[model samples]
Target: MTEVLTKRKTLLEARDLHVQFASRGRKARAVDGVNLAVGEGEIVALVGESGCGKTTLARTLLGLERPTSGQVLYGGAGLDYGSRALKAYRREVQLVLQDPTGSLNPRHTVYEAVAEGPRIHGLANEEEIVRDALSRAGLRPPERFFLRYPHELSGGQRQRVVIAGALALAPRLLVADEPVASLDASVRGEILALLLRLREELGLSALVVTHDLGLAWNIADRVAVMYLGRIVESGPVEQVLTAPRHPYTQALLSVLPESPEPVVLTGEPPDPTRVPGGCRFHPRCQVLGVGRAAEVGVDGKCKGEPLAVLPAVPEPQVACHYAAATGS
Candidate 1:
């Protein structure tokens, strides 16, 4: 199926973003030349293993971290972090951290926690805003939870409270980082449902950052696979998840518990400071040697030209030379 990329109006965009940091005298490229977009009312999953730069990209998108070399566009305009516009933009977008325990204040009551945003911004009707936010986040009868503290709530409740805090500001877009990783498996469904419910009820968009492909399958409208600081594959969730084009993406999905044939690799992904030349994934591609290198289209060029994301019609965009040749 040819998946059209622009099925909705874009809400946020990252263009050739590069966010690097100095580590041990070498540059650690956490996010390298990544171009991504989240459309209005769309739930997009940004998936990758740890240290693949997904978190960094999320932070950059939220303006929590500055990109070293690219522009982060919010609603189609580049954000100038110094201006008043950036602050206003932030109020429109909010972040849900991975760990509820770490994000929620140990001392603050649910009311205080949810009320902080509006109070800080000097918005009107703090009490009403807090109740509405909590209710929207699925803490039914928000008054019942207003006096409770983080410890007084269940794992799921605490997550909902964290979510409520974000929703309090009436954000149009949410950047949820590992939103369910800290919750119990049973409660994970509840939180995921809440996210979907918020989108449906409030006309909100979301960028859900997680390594779980199943979660993406469950809720996201689209999926983007990140590897070594760049997007290797992205398209409609059903298309990219079922028919991954990049070799790295194919290897990732092959190991899914449901996959009939699972393919494994020999080594770990290379270090960020010492990434492989040409294609970052070339060193670990299993089929590179299985088929004659020439026949498989793996050659010196594959090991030399750093792969950039290729624009493909109908999405399912890829960055691997062998993707077209091997049908991966």
Candidate 2:
């Protein structure tokens, strides 16, 4: 992982990022103190369960949501929020949302859909750019699909069009939120393959946000396990997925089809509007009051003292008292 970092340039980064919202007169910390990065032409997967703030983090990174504090950087420069600056920044950073059906306009033809970005950015050679993007997105014979509307295409084709739209802009990084969650089993692999091929052919970098660890294993160069509103564990895909140090990550992986001993977590994650003082995961953490944590005598701290935010580094990092105590 360190070698990969040294070899490639860091394209996009988040520093102590926090996104808060006013909910029922309380602050909901959707993205709390997250530090992450994606290198040039690298794929990083942000995996977590639903409502774990992965989507919010993705939005914040795309500049859709303003952070309460902290900053997002691109090419080592802080993001500018002014309308013109944001518009220019968006051209370099595009988002491929979860649902293709919703992302596309049923009234718009495939050509219009793919041409939207180039048009908005006032780029020339519209026809050529659209064709190139479509072909690159695996929709060969691009002219055949140009006149087709969203309702006229198959699920996989619609997704390809979505990818083409992002590709049309020639973005430096793609922040994909649940990129394949809406596709059928057979089609999911196709999109994943397209993303990989794009990275190889175009040197495109991606931040893939999904809950599927298997997806991460298949496509990601690195994996970040998010819980509640923070990244609890992250490292190289081979390291973190194979030997997860955080209990939350362990619990998540145990439910996969191949696990011999599954770990079942009780209760729901606490509300972000009222996060617990100690470890935010303490109430539902299986390792806190029993097993190794109790033996290591950090059980009390687990319920009363918050763990420091995990730093973004090349090596594996886990934010759990038990993990820190045992040095695993």
Candidate 3:
């Protein structure tokens, strides 16, 4: 297989990534032959269904789970987990998990949790480190929240504390996995705003893993749509969301709970273990038959064979074979 070279200065790059697990005496590809890149100081959102590889990909990016076969390059250099580069990479790339409550230690106070990273890395004085992290996370009057434990704070406060911990290391890239999922509806907006503010203030890049299209629409600069361990489509947010090209992508956007009731796709998503032949989504796709194919001018791409590799597109290349059909 030929490698696709990207000219953009990628802060983090995953090439032909494959993450698999042993189950029932066979390897299950949780993340299969994936390719992804995050540009310097850019926010790229990874969106997909529940069983898709979003979480697994995020974990792989952080080096928490080693891919069976692949290369993770940090700053154009390959990630060597056993070397000093790995340690430095960890400091540069931090993760903010989905469950804020579970992520923080109940025994440790907010100050302790936030200061843990700097202490481990021996990066700063404890007092200044805690204070600075709390301040950066918008947990003003840092002293007020210092002694508070996870149970002592509200949902929003707990999430803020977690964010503070991730920021303590002053990471270049932050992988936020459903950061707002556990928060109250009212607080969701506030958290999103806080993230945007931090991005501007710290000049940090982010990879937000979310299943909610609306949230991605509101926050992400570019969106990467994942399906069954592969990126089915990816492009600028407006182009992908407003006029989605991939059949699966279009079906996904149509089901979003927007006002006026978007197009409801018939049938359900394919089973993960028993993916259909050709396009994994073809079984559930509504864009079948001659007329619809001609409408998009991508009839052959979708019908011929399951695309083993992502086809090239003009803007921010999409993985889909029928990307041009969507008129994006």
Q: Write the per-residue lDDT of candidate 2 for residues 1-328, one digit (tens) a residue.
A: 6587658788999999999999999999988899998999999999999988999999999999999999999999999999999999999999998999999999999999999999999999999999999999989899999999999999999999999999999998999999999999999999999999999998999999999999999999999999889999998999998999988899999989999999878767658898887788888888874656789888888889898887777678888878888898
Q: Order the numbered candidates by TM-score, best leading.
A: 2, 1, 3
Candidate 3 lowest-lDDT run of ten: 1-10
Which tens-of-lDDT digit does each residue in 158-254 have in candidate 3?
A: 9999999988898999999999998899999988998888888887889999998888998877788998888888777877788777777876787
- Backbone clashes in each candidate structure, one number apiece? 0, 0, 0
Off by over 4 Å in 3: 1-8, 259-272, 289-291, 294-304, 311-328
| Highest TM-score scorer | 2
Using lDDT as the yardstick, the better of models 1 and 2 is: 2
Q: Which digits, one per residue and each the tens of the lDDT, describe model 1 over residues 162-274?
A: 99999999999999999999888999999999999999998899999999998999999889898888888888889898878776777788878898988787577657887
Pick by TM-score: 2 or 3, better one:
2
Off by over 4 Å in 1: 1-5, 292-294, 311-314, 326-328
Q: What is candidate 2's CA lDDT for residue 122? A: 96
Q: Counting only residues 3 or more apart in sequence or on different chains, how many pairs clash (N, Cα, C under 3 Å) in candidate 3?
A: 0
The residue pairs found clashing in candidate 1 are: none
